[model samples]
Target: MARLVYQPQSPLNATLAVSKRWATSLGIWGVGAGTAALFLLSVTPLVKREFLVKVPVVGSYYEDKTPASDKPF
Candidate 1:
């Protein structure tokens, strides 16, 4: 014979349950915001060196091919 245990859900569980309903929408919005941020920051050297340059397909596109000596500044 097995005894049944009753467990009450906490507020955190309730919040998580509600959030599950909006998960897909939230994910889409998050991705859109991140993409917009990346695009807006794309011209910055930090973003270019740290992120855009590591993207596989377009990595070569962002690579700086110029020799250091060729730069005027």
Candidate 2:
């Protein structure tokens, strides 16, 4: 007769197979990705303008306007 082994069902049971150094590297990567996402979200207008200016046919006509006109009239 063979004995059955009991496996833990907690989340901690799932462990990354990589080394500790690689785990730290993953943290760094996560931080970098979060920072980049935040930066992109913060500068959405600038990113949109850049994308608009990169279009093949409409790029040449795109212009950046002064911020003064954005106030409520």
Strongest candidate by lDDT:
1
Q: Which ranges of candidate 2 are over 4 A from the true structure?
A: 1-21, 44-70
lDDT tens digits, residue span 1-73, model 1: 9999998999999999999999999999999999999999989989999989999999989888999999998
Q: Candidate 2, TM-score vs. the true structure? A: 0.35
lDDT of 1: 0.94
Please give each candidate's TM-score. Answer: 0.74, 0.35
Worst 10 residues of 1 by lDDT: 57-66
